[model samples]
Target: MFFAGDIGGTKVNLALCEVHDGRITTQFLRRYSSAQFGSLSDVLVRYVKEIGPLSGKIEGTCFGVPGPVLNGRCHTVNLPWTPDSAEIARDLAQVVEAGPVQLINDLEATAYGIGLLQKSGQGLSILRAATGAIGHRANQALLAPGTGLGEAMLLWDGIRHVISPSEGGHADFGPQDEEQIELLRWLWPRHKHVSWEHVASGPALHRLYRFLKETGRETEPAELAEALAQPGVDASPVIAAMAIRGQYPICVRAFDLWLFFVGAEAGNLALKSLSLGGIFIGGGIIPNVLELFRRPAFFAGLDSKGRMSSVVAGMPVYGIVDPLTALYGAAFSAAHSHGVLHGFR
Candidate 1:
């Protein structure tokens, strides 16, 4: 059996996986609140104890961290602690006795898992059909917006794909319209640098709602406002749920802006990577709101690219429907990469 984890800003998914019939699959899985634990090791130790009877059975271990990993270390932008793979290996030596712990970017793990998922022909939906041809394999990209945005590229060098992790999500935020231009201006004072992440991620949903409400563009409902103001409540989900139900106009507007940003950034990634193979949307949000994402407003921002409109609008788009893709990928990478993979900058 192999151990794997999908570590994110909001939560951590840990699992024990085994390869059966030439396919890697999880046997035991659990999710933990990331903020509750001080370190990755804390969660691992707890998981080790809770799973029970798996002592020293884990052959290899890998984690998909939310930040860039360099030389087996990562300084997480969203989480508080920095994790070192070598140290983690030592900490878990008594429990699993596995090899060195491999730390890969979450997007890298997702990319690897996406390749595996594509082969199975399951848990993937084509949000936008390819305008030209069906099986064009040249280049591909992934745009994931969750606690933060993630970007990656799959370079098909005439043979197999090479997964490349990127921090393109941190790149500058360029407005596509006058309304978005005003949104940028509103955000400039609050953030040192308002990247696409500031407007596109799970957390950004609340910020968008606040912007719309505070700017007098929309009126906030009294009861909903009270619920949002209550401490410890996550407004992002509340707004998203309302938008999904088509209830409140304010929530609908924020959701619309979120989709527009997703589209713009997805198009930007496609252009930068020349991802003709396809563009895959993976993340916490899009999968849950697939129907909402299929609307024209989302494609409007994507197809708005001035000169290269046709190039981008024609590329196929897919949503990763499986939630455990990164967890599966971590295990898959560990199994195939000999516990290590390159391109961690």
Candidate 2:
């Protein structure tokens, strides 16, 4: 048996999965708000008490943390506490016979989950002939937009799979038009280097809304949703809310802008790695507005590269709908670390 967790600032999900018949089976799963406890240890204690008997036979565990893990310790991006993998190992060791614990970036976990998806043929796939042109196997990149932008790539490392992390999302946001340039000018005073995270994240969305309000444009997704449902007053939510409602011009425009950047970024990644692998969009944001992504403009951006357009065109793109993707990646990491699965760790 193995234990794993997907820990974030707002919530933590803990689960136990038993490796049997070459498959990882979920034994138990639970969720808790991190703010409700002083430390992650408290949540772990409660989970163990409720689940019972996690001793002796369990091999190891892994954690997917939202923040960077340096020297085995992680500082939560939005929370007031820090987590040390060594300390966590010692504590859980008492219960599960003291095994090693692995810590990986949350984006790394998402990448692993993405690799798993490809292995199962449950993810997007590119034309084999097209991949042959690049002389690589099919795979995808994971772009997760949450508190900040997180990115990872699952690539065919010759023989097996490898999950590579990227700080590209923080690589700077280039404006595409007059409006975007104006937006960037508005944001420059507040931040030194504005990356995609500056305009593509949750807080960024709120910031845009605030900007609109400051400019005398009403910007409330909830209010827009309410208004659109009533019919006479035509208002739009964020890229997502409008997408979900089906058809609204302002919502459509908002989503178009969002997709243009996302696809262009994906194209850039695809070019850098020569990823014959597809691009998988993960995050709390895009899956909510996936319907809009299917629009013509979105795919156009992915194929917008002048000379390299043909190269990116062949790479498949997918939006991961599963919320537990990172958790699954944690489980995958644990299994691989134990040598239960090849190409893991």
Indicate the worst ten consecutive residues by lDDT in candidate 1.
336-345
For candidate 1, write residues 69-90 as lDDT tens digits: 9999988999997989988998
lDDT of 2 at 191: 89
Worst 10 residues of 2 by lDDT: 123-132
* Number of backbone clashes in candidate 1: 0
Which parts of model 2 have CA positions greater than 4 angstroms off? 54-56, 93-98, 123-139, 216-239, 246-250
Provide backbone clash counts, one per model.
0, 4
TM-score versus the correct structure, for each prediction = 0.95, 0.83
After TM-score superposition, the amount by which residue 164's alpha carbon in candidate 2 deviates from its true location, in angstroms, is 1.7
Highest lDDT, which number?
1
Residue 86 shift from truth in candidate 1, angstroms: 0.5
lDDT of each: 0.87, 0.70
